[model samples]
Target: MKQSNFTTWFKSGSPWVWMNAGAVAIAVIMTLGLLILIAVRGLSHFWPADIVEAEYTIPGQPAITLLGEVTTREQVPTERLQGAGLPVDPEQNEFMDRELLKVGNRDLYGADFRWIVADWLSNERYPEDVIAIERREWGNFYGYLLSVSHDGEVVAEGEQAIDALQAAVERASGIYDEIHSLETGAIGKINTELERLRLRERGYELDNALTADRQAELEAERAVQNARYAELESELVDLYREFNRDSIMTRAMDGQEKRISLSAIVRVFQPNAMGITDKIGHYFAKLWEFVSDEPREANTEGGVFPAIFGTVLMVLLMSIIVTPFGVLAAVYLREYAKQGFVTRTIRIAVNNLAGVPSIVYGVFGLGFFIYFLGGNIDQLFFREALPSPTLGTGGMLWASLTLALLTVPVVIVATEEGLTRIPRSLREGSLALGATKAETLWKVILPMSSPAMMTGLILAVARAAGEVAPLMLVGVVKLAPTLPLNANYPYLHLDQKFMHLGFHIYDVGFQSPNVEAARPLVYATALLLVGVIASLNFAAVAIRNHLREKYKALEN
Candidate 1:
């Protein structure tokens, strides 16, 4: 009966054991898969592709060199050849071309080429011409011409000069019309009056009543009219001079030359040799540049360095603000304070604070921090920085304080756990050695709990680093022109609004209309954040382990 009972019990328990093991195995597999996927996708962004050349000919036009795959004329469809306007004998084209080429698999015409089209013609009727060729077979007779031409300039200054000259001519035409109108109206009127006066004088002479006074008056009027005509003539001459085509063309050409020169300089400065690897390298380089450089207009290129600097500075400030208060609260509650209704209530409050919605904290931060504390600070300490509203507005210092408040519970809980784990006998032993309670707590208890304190700090840092909602209300901006730390009069200005990576991810992912382009960046940033937090946690754990080992003997 005992042997039967034992068998039954083993059978019942064995299934449960297998089930638990299976569950663990599945979890392990899933974790490995997730990690592998992340690494593969992230690192694949840096792979490079081979560059190739190909030739294409349009009938009646010179062969064009394209950088990509090469293909044989025979392999290319007759319709495609016809579309290119190449004369192909429909009956013999296939067989004759195939025999003439005698293309082998190893031949250049048969080789594959990779190319990106720099230019393509677009028309609905001939849609094939407009399509970009990513790859092509190189064995064709035309395939050899696709190599990059050393003489091909990306932009032609001569063409730009012609464009500018055309613009200038158009402008001059408008001015010419104005000048012509003035000349016709004023000068034509003067000429007509002169003719009328001459006619009147002829009549007077015929009547034989032409007096000296009349002649003098007529001469004076003629002289005045002639002066007006001369003035109009001079103005027209000036307008013609101003609108001179040669001068306008010369200026336009000069301006275009200068612009092209600057553009060439910029291009020269840019690294032009691009491969997949090179492109990925450039992306990271640019990201670093953005983080390190000063902020500029969104359309311009500059470093987002100010935002990065501000974010780091603000988080550090928050750590400074939260660490001492949280640790002290935790120490008092776990060690010094008696377990009572007040202590229980305080613990409840701390837990509740952790659960409160972050957005609610943001609202509270905006109202209480920006308006109440900032207003008071502005009135007291930052009166000189008024009108700019240094302390009486959203800023880095207030943002840090708000975030610190939000993460206080995380630090408190971690620190309290660290404190609770300290053996009571350690305190008793310290007292037996004639050490005072305060001294025992400081020297023995605090030292042993150092790892827990570090753990708390790490947790707090992680929470602060990722908190975006509170930052939005407190001081985080889409862009910050200057860093929080600078050589300006008072270094480390706390009143500046700053940019943060978490906020940046939010802005780029949600706020931006271009989701496709920003999506990759969002993933990259998220990966970076996770890496940073993981590294911090690992470091803290290492320290904790070392401390635990050091205190292992005392635990007994």
Candidate 2:
């Protein structure tokens, strides 16, 4: 009876089907769980959490007052805490709850975070008068507003200080904008011209053509640019003076007063006093800034627009580069190559290359592309920039090419599979009707294969966006001084080094000096990277779907 029952169940095929369905369900649940965890830990960082003021007492130490935001909490058995050298009375408590606070006056407190026993906390309050200041240099400042001053004199005190300080910040912000504009715009133009003049003179010398007329022209241009530079410098000096004219005084929990320049401040907020509507507005504003601003403080704070731009730009360049080469190679192999031992061996090699490590491709690109090809180009055409190694360095161009090399096998294999799907009757019919074999393949075969090519591209993008190890050796950096793309001729600067979101996550998560401060940013950056890759894949998939629908008639 048991043998017959087993035979009947096996013959029904329901067991195998259930097993496959169960596996798929498990995968979906795991993926959603990961995304939810990432979202909660990352997106919640932008919200304006209420600050807590409390008194903490520990055994054998003086009772002290703590002022900051409660970032996290942990519970431990009293016996375990005692074993770890923390004095906890097991008779009084079975478990001790500890709260981690972000006490963000780093310059004053030596550290921005502290953990204390929550059971001992007393006089806990959320004071409405507390202020939080975000700065360009120091991580953050938390204190009570003391006074607002301008040029060594007090402008406002008491309840009016917040209003006065906000007005000063507005004026300082305008001046800061002027400074940035002058530096990046007019002065930047003059600097570029000066650089061009220098490069032109270098080229002439390298070519043995630095004649008297060329020398005179160079000097004349240099003098004009220098004069313009001097005028901009004078303007910059005045702006700096005005920018530093106002200051705000703040008192820490321990009653230590600090005078911070308005120029250094990014923003100031009274979180405890803000209503829910105000908090929501501020949260959205912060999210926008996170997506738009340049990173500061070792990439622990600020926006990652440069990284986002670089990742997208590099992937697009790789796509532009890989697609054509992959298609051509696949076409020759599938449609033109003689099918024999050599062809079989070449096919095996291509398939093997797909499994080669990405880092090996990065190394190959560095040696062959940068050192060999790029070095030769620099020597032949850019001799003037030889020592500076213009193209002969790991940069955006080489990075993209390396990724293209790494992902090209996938494209080739996919394209060949697509080409194979072209019905033999279509090719024969087109050839018989007056089209040559080339015309038949180009007009009838390639169009039907485009969807597969797009599928390959989607897979390539998904892999490339998350790659960090290869990029680190190729061109990615901890911090990029300037963006590769800017307001200049030939706006896409291929030879410039760039940042990647994947690398950003690695640096913030592992290389940061302040682990506690960088933890949230790492999660946020990781989530952003995942979103970016998914968006690219979705775009490619959409195109593939459209192409498939368009060419479905031909396939039939």
Candidate 3:
């Protein structure tokens, strides 16, 4: 009767236990799966290749090849280009000297061949001048055409008119400056007089007849000063009229330069949806150029290689910082320290710190590390760099230190758990064999617990890799032209600001004026970061399983 009762009770509790276990397993699996998806999507944005044509013609200049083949605008109908949805600026045609043509839509302006010609008068006066052009297309192109020339009479008249206008502006500016200086002096005198009047009013409290007649004379002088100041202000306004006088007068001097209409040029190269696809291909090609070349401007054909290098370097530095400190703390707490009130209190403090918001850490790091410790270090070791701030500033080293602090608890918790799982007999046996405590820990305890140590490191790394808030206050920048590591003197300067992937995503998404276009890139970068963390975790797990299997016989 007793055996039957025990069997019934065990069966009833089994279902509940199995249900809880299954739910936990499912949750873990789903989390890992999400991470893998994000990583895959992000890495794919850098891959893919495509092509499109860029076309433009000079004003009053027939399109002729170096080989002497004349291609009239009439021969190539604007409809061919329009069907392709090529970009055309009617305003550019109305105001500028030369017609402009680009490979694709203006919104996709960064991905193609962009051309512009300054108006005729400015063109000759600044002979080496080149109009701003952008090639914001995806793929490579086979052919490019540009015509540059101007009629002699139109060019000469435009140049003469611009010169006359510039002379007039210079003369007006001189007059404006003189009047402005005089007005400023007059205003200052008026203010002085007003202050005197105020002091005189205070004197009235002591005496009734204190300079009443003198005060009236000063007020009259102040009114005259005010009138002169207004006159000068009016003269300054008239100076602006001289600024655009050249352009306006030139238009009246010579009819607007004879130019091919950009709209007419677009009608020549138009393509269908196939053309759009082709242009997207060209866009990718242009993007590749940017990725492979050195940086030119903030927005230009250049690679993000420096940023990538800086991000990886910073993360690696942070890992180096966090790992040893975290692992040591965990080892001490789990193996050496007794479970007393103080130890328990310390553990609670660590857990609470882990839950504290990241931004708070940023502020703390900025104040304590950058201002205090760095300032002290500079004062002691770098006395020559006094007041210039050796350590009292943001840089790669401080950033790493800040992130290390943020990730310490994560590593400590992971390591402590791993240490707890080692059977107590292993330590007892080492001691029985006459091995010293230090030797036992170095030879057996650490080696045995290494897989768990690695697991903790992996978890810490995953968290640190994506952290942005603390980094912002420490040293991460939106754009870093050169990486922290370089072939210059002091190859690795810890004081320099570095770029990071998480910060890059924020910059491209929120800071860019072209947010709509940058959206895809943001998604791609996010995916890459997720993938990197997931891959590291997977490797750690693999190592853990291998260690478990290798130690199986010893456990027995």
Give the best candidate by lDDT: 2
Better candidate number, 2 or 3, judged by TM-score: 2
Best by TM-score: 2
Candidate 3 lDDT over residue span 313-431, tens digit each: 77688778988899899988977899899999999999898898888888989999999998889777665445577578899999888888988998888778878888989999999
Computed on alpha carbons, the lDDT of every model, listed in order, comes to: 0.60, 0.90, 0.58
Better of 1 and 3 by TM-score: 1
Ranking by lDDT: 2, 1, 3
Error of 1 at 502 (Å): 0.7
How far does residue 323 in candidate 2 sit from its true spot (Å)?
A: 0.4
**Separate clash counts for every candidate:** 24, 0, 35
Q: In lDDT terms, how accurate is model 3? A: 0.58
* Model 1 steric clash total: 24
Q: All predictions: root-mean-square deviation over Cα?
A: 22.4, 1.5, 18.9
Clashing pairs in 2: none
Q: Candidate 1: worst 10 consecutive residues by lDDT? A: 261-270
lDDT of 3 at 97: 32
- CA lDDT for candidate 1: 0.60
Q: Please identify model 1 stretches exceeding 4 Å from their true place.
A: 1-304
